[model samples]
Target: MTRSDDESRRVYATQGLIDLLLERAAAADPARENVVLDATPAGEFDADLGVDPATPVLTHFYLPAGRAVSDVFGVDLGTPAGRGRARFLTHPQGPAELTRRDDLAGVVLLAVPPWGTETLTAFDRQGRRLPLTVLDAEPPVESLPE
Candidate 1:
């Protein structure tokens, strides 16, 4: 069966989550940076995810360095039945204080109206959602040097 607009939106959100996870993992640790998108298990499907009923998408990003690091942020996205759920995990020690005047820590979440469009969301270590303004339109720059 063809996917619905809601289904497509959820898929887009989930994929965006996966991308963010990978980017963070790579920045936090180069060696342990990896992302896995697994098909949802038969009985583990949640109606709130907003995706296809037959296929549940589970994305996981492994960051070995982040295991013990404080002041870190973890994000996950899941889609079931065309709705998207975004989650943010913060380190116990909280985010590090900014030593530089230009330093900033924040998250941005965007949802396209009318459904079936790509949704964008971001978060900081504090699990707060940042506003998406025209100034934030530029794509994220690489955190690590090539």
Candidate 2:
């Protein structure tokens, strides 16, 4: 198989893993109600090409915001319940600009609970918390694509 074909397979496998995770999360929590699985992008890159021809992909999965505030931190944010309480505050910088900037290529899985509005968390492809913030609770917007 060609290099491009291998890369495509890898990307597909990665997406499958992410899909499985979301499915498990939904099954684990029936109340999870809204589960969104954004699609990852497929592409080609050249090493000889100047500037790493990478890209940033944002896959946002919005759930309801929870209603409990915990002084406890550093918990496993990958859990369905845990991520429900987490929010993406900011990136390596402050919590100002978290939008796609360059071809860095990253995946964000956001879980906003339905009950509360002050929760937000962004997880990486490996389900690790990057940064999060808690704001005034707001109802989850039902804008996710089916």
Candidate 3:
């Protein structure tokens, strides 16, 4: 696929992600539902936990300005609801990794923080805070000692 095709394909993929998250949220039992968040954009990040590539990655974006606002979203990745929020922190993207914005920094936990809304906005400039999630975080590169 060309660059345009790739970009277009992502549009569809992102849409699908929204659908799944709504389902998960509705059926979410606070006792069981859990989401993940990276403290910082530091290094590489992860979008999908362990599901297939088709599984949509979740995201939250503020409208108008398209800046990131803390919100929670999720998917029962690679497991059943009984597992209860299996999202574990990977890299230190939160405060521990922040070179700036420490006031907004936090631990890179799998659970998304509560935003007092049902949806997580991934970039709805129109102003709909649907729990938009994404799994497009890049993984850390491994380097060997020289």
Candidate 4:
């Protein structure tokens, strides 16, 4: 298969997994409908993440609560300027607008680049950052031929 084909399949599978998780969450708690996660991009998908001053770093992370991700990014603990460059991902659909019976789960595009990300954080409805549990992916031993 072509590289584009592989990428398309990857995107489809990732979205399917997210849908399954949302379904399961809804089944467990009927009141969890229309759950707005803080891991969504607050504005345009192509918004500059400000990771680098010379170049724009764009990333949209839609991390599910209590789930392990395949990608990992380290926080810039050595640089004090990193804290000022932090960008938060918040759901576009405000929580106050959602009703108890709205089962519409927010659609998240998970096609994110792993580079230029200094820090990652998720927040609750009360604006408290929740601890994230990440599962780092093993590095590939070889690269695919172009």
lDDT of each: 0.32, 0.33, 0.30, 0.28
Winner by lDDT: 2
TM-score of each: 0.24, 0.22, 0.22, 0.19
Instruction: Estimate, for each residue in 1-146, the C-alpha lDDT of model 3 and write its tens digit.
Output: 57554443231113333344444544553433334322223222344344344433333211121123222224323333342211221112222122222212121112232412232322222222223234445443447899
Off by over 4 Å in 3: 1-13, 35-118, 122-146
Per model, state how many residue pairs clash.
16, 18, 24, 0
Q: How does residue 70 of candidate 4 score in lDDT?
A: 17
User: How does candidate 3 score on lDDT?
Assistant: 0.30
> Looking at candidate 4, what is the lDDT of residue 66?
28
lDDT of 2: 0.33
Better of 1 and 3 by TM-score: 1
lDDT of 2 at 9: 27
What are the C-alpha RMSDs, in order, of all predicted structures? 16.7, 15.9, 16.0, 16.5
Error of 4 at 99 (Å): 20
Task: Please write out the lDDT profile of model 2 over residues 19-116, one tens digit for every residue.
Answer: 44445444544333323333322223212222123422223343423323222444323335523321222232223223453111243434333212
Instruction: Point out where model 2 deviates above 4 Å.
Output: 1-30, 34-36, 40-53, 59-108, 113-118, 124-127, 131-146
Give per-residue lDDT, candidate 4, residue 33: 25
After aligning candidate 3 to the native by TM-score, how far in Å is the CA of 134 from where it should be?
9.2
The reply for model 1, stretches above 4 Å from the true place, is 1-23, 29-32, 41-43, 61-146
Candidate 3 vs candidate 4: which has greater lDDT? 3
